[model samples]
Target: MTDDVPAQSLMLPVLLRPVISDLEKTDVAAAQTLRAALVKVENVHPGFTHDLVLGLVKKADLSINMNEALLRLQGQVADTDSEYRLRRAEEPFQELNRRSSLLKKILSRIPDEITDRRAFLDTIKEIASAIKKLLDVVNEIAGYIPGSTGKQALEQRKRDFVRYSKKFSTTLKEYFREGQPSAVFASALYLIHQTNLMIVTIKNKCE
Candidate 1:
């Protein structure tokens, strides 16, 4: 697989068909069982099977450094949020800190390796949910700005935030589909750091 391949375009069925065919040649029963499990997972969580397969392939290739990458992400989140207390009001800062803490907790749950599929899936979902909550807090902060000039500035920042969020999501998805765990974690950290900066910017404008 090449980097040029789009994440959504890399269908799990297409990628697994040939591999399953080969597996069936050696062990038909095993191949059938694997296919059935994948189908069940896909039914419950679309696109997850693709991520799982890509992750396994990358793990086999020794391309992922999960522990180190996660540590770096955790550090980045901490460093970015360290300034929140100084830059923001007490209430907003506390909310932001709470959200950041939740995110860090979720990040800590991801293991050094993808040993358990269900656990990894749960962690990923938690991470996604935490990120959305953080973004919503930032949006709430943005909504409080008054005056025409502040509103205009907030609008521009909101546009930038939305654009960057989309880019982050796309890049992260591509990293996952390509089985680049380090890249996935880095992209996630980047988004969180950018979010912190956005909150600071909005707070400044509000003041």
Candidate 2:
């Protein structure tokens, strides 16, 4: 749960292969179309996977906002439970938790697959921004609690970032060849190092 926690080694779902096979069997043309689109995107943007993750983050944000609105409406109509646990035990939190879990799973796939420098740096930037937004959403959700029940989770997010940032640093190192910072790859390397440092700083500042 903490930011410094090591990455979980998750196997790709067994159903994924069967599901894709079923899709190919059921609608070959649609499956081909999907494949073509993915290939095109991969050709154009090597970092397309990162973009996909960012899109998921946006979706999560929308879900959170809708949940907030619903809670507000519920509040206006009738005063609900006083305890945070009771509220968190509801549908909205469950949905948010699901989204968060999915987002993390997708993100965990990126480092191993994307090796290009430009794509890697771009992915790192997007991930940093997305994670910041996610933590903010966490805080907002916690605000619904009467006390500080949410503090641990928020702190854990910070520590998780620390671990993720270290992972980024390691992955970036793989693509970096010996060169002056004047070159594009070197410049990217410098920027990535800075970004990792910034993540460390942000994590340290979290209470």
Candidate 3:
């Protein structure tokens, strides 16, 4: 029994390693999918897409650095300690991973060309809904962290997302009534911008 307990305890960290690795992989894949979707939008709205794409690229770079930092931290921790923290945070990480996968799937629905207005509008609406779900998960994860600053930052992000979502809704309504593509495009860009910022905030504060 004694030998078995030691062996099982030693195996815990090894088992947990794949969970962190998988989360990191999911995050990277989601970022790539989102970037691709933005590029497709760029083809249609050249004037607005460039800045958002640039911002996303910068944030993605930061996310990579943060992931490296997390790996380094994991290595620094004692095996038992690492296992405990990983186990504690595992559920939030899994939830975040799940939401990110859903976001990627939704982003994939964005058409390559915005030629079909109804279709494009429907896709953005779905994207908006997915983003909201992601934000909710992020906010919940942030709540578990200790610092008030992190919580406050997440709150601000929530407020920003709400504002962007409202703009999207209003512009969507305008698009339906007057059929001005520009307004809808602008709102969509705002949502995308907010999403990138929220992602960066998640890395900065939550992770």
Candidate 4:
């Protein structure tokens, strides 16, 4: 009904073609690079998995997000982005993204570090509950079958907890000694610490 519709419709396609072409090209290039980068899905920009997993854990209301975030933080270089995104050739965009990643890492830790350990403890509490339930089920349900896979998974989980707990202890010592960071930042930091500790404790028990 507008005067511009016919003209705009014709022009829109002309204008959009270049952009669509460019996007397709970018996707192809990125796909080629990623195909070469990962042997298994596990190697796909580990950070994406990490951010996703942390998000998932949080979504599930588990307390393990902080400890996982901390571990994810340790190796993350600012330059390399998640393998899934298209790599830009423009230096400014690349630099900006790299810097952005650093900020993201810092920001992500805030929730865990500032919040109280209650969330972290709750994660452990949940784990304890789940494990007890699993054991109960296994005890009640297992026939004469001898496969130890359930027990093995439990052991692996326990080992993971022990390793993370040691790291959490060291980090907590530094965290407390640093005098409470700003109030805005406090809750997140507390949360991170608590979550990390909870993850460690639960993982230890599961091991």
Candidate 5:
């Protein structure tokens, strides 16, 4: 019983960012509603937090792809409103975005059922898989654009994913099994943020 108690006592570190508190104190009054909603949930579930952060990462990626697709249509279509083959390329991002939203909703509903470390890690795998799929989709989309720069940008993002994938694997081995959930989660969070910033830079180049 004592041994079981020690295992049960293991807790995820309180490394969660002060997201709600910071929002309340800052001049970002526009986000007050979101802040309020978050505060209402006294104990923010880790799984929910994972989904939210991952959702934003996925959204940023899709936005980058959408922006690139629009750029591909540039000069191809008579105007933004005109029909073009490149415009159809945006359908995949739309589908991906819809899937991200659905994932968030489903995860939010299942947090109570996934507090086990193994289960949470499995969800992390899902997030990683989703990011990989997005990377592949971006590459496929770039194929139809047909430009050296476009191909180069996609290749760069692919390289970034590979780096992050390695980092994630290393962190998972070093921290997750050592009972350090915060380290593993933080590594994933940082990777997503970094990748999103990279994608944003690529999107800006499309302009």
Candidate 6:
């Protein structure tokens, strides 16, 4: 049994080179193309929904760190009339901080379930709800901008921004739902479709 095992191990290399060299050459280019294609696929899919969630969390942090601090200081210096506004700002900051922490952790775990299209789509919807809440907080802030014209414009822009983001979020969700990138990844991948063109251009320059 020991002699048979040694003889079998020695024969392993005999069938490898001719088979491996041709296979490796073909696969290497394919792998490169797939890698490049994935980048294109990711970009065309637009701003990742996961990033938007993190972005809102960051925005919430800014509101807590900067705006809330300013409001508290302003309240201390103001007449009693403005105390309510300071309280309002402080309340939302606290609530948003809680929401943001939950969201940050949720975002961290997303890459694992991202391959499941249904879950990925659901996450898009969930993040959109969170975004809507963020925009609502912004709208509340806009109402207190201290001047008639500026406050009106701020409110207008807030509405427009919300509308724009909703459309973008929907488009990204649709792109993932269609599952085109996964299909493309499974196929050729096309990491660098212009590789030959680039090589030829480089050769011409050298010549």
Query: Could you say which candidate leads in TM-score?
Result: 1
Given candidate 5, what's the lDDT at residue 107?
A: 28
- Residue ranges of candidate 2 with Cα displaced over 4 Å: 1-102, 105-113, 149-153, 156-207
lDDT of 1 at 45: 78
**What is the lDDT of every predicted structure here?**
0.57, 0.39, 0.52, 0.38, 0.43, 0.37
Deviation from native of the Cα of residue 87 in model 1, angstroms: 5.9
Per residue, candidate 1 scores C-alpha lDDT tens digits across 52-83 of: 75678687886644333433345334533333
TM-score of each prediction: 0.51, 0.34, 0.49, 0.27, 0.46, 0.35
Candidate 5 at residue 122, lDDT? Answer: 72
Model 4: ten consecutive residues of lowest lDDT? 5-14
Model 6, poorest ten-residue lDDT window? 186-195
Q: Which has the better lDDT: candidate 4, or candidate 5?
A: 5
Per-residue lDDT of model 6, residues 50-124, tens digit only = 233336659777533221222122212222211111223355533433333333233333444457878866765
> What are the per-residue Cα lDDT tens digits for candidate 3 across 55-134?
66597774332212222232233222321222235677556655654554444343332457778767777777777777
Predict model 6's lDDT versus the native: 0.37
Candidate 5 ranges with C-alpha deviation above 4 Å: 1-89, 96-115, 144-146, 205-207
lDDT of 2 by residue, 1-207 (tens): 221111000000111223344688889987777656754665676546434534675977744322122212222211111211122455445444443433343343343335555775676676566555545555555544343434554456556545655554554565466422122222222222232333233233332
| lDDT for model 5 | 0.43
Candidate 3, which segments miss by more than 4 Å at Cα? 1-89, 104-125
Candidate 1: worst-modelled 10 consecutive residues by lDDT: 1-10
lDDT of 3 at 169: 75
Give residue 72's error in model 4 in angstroms: 9.1
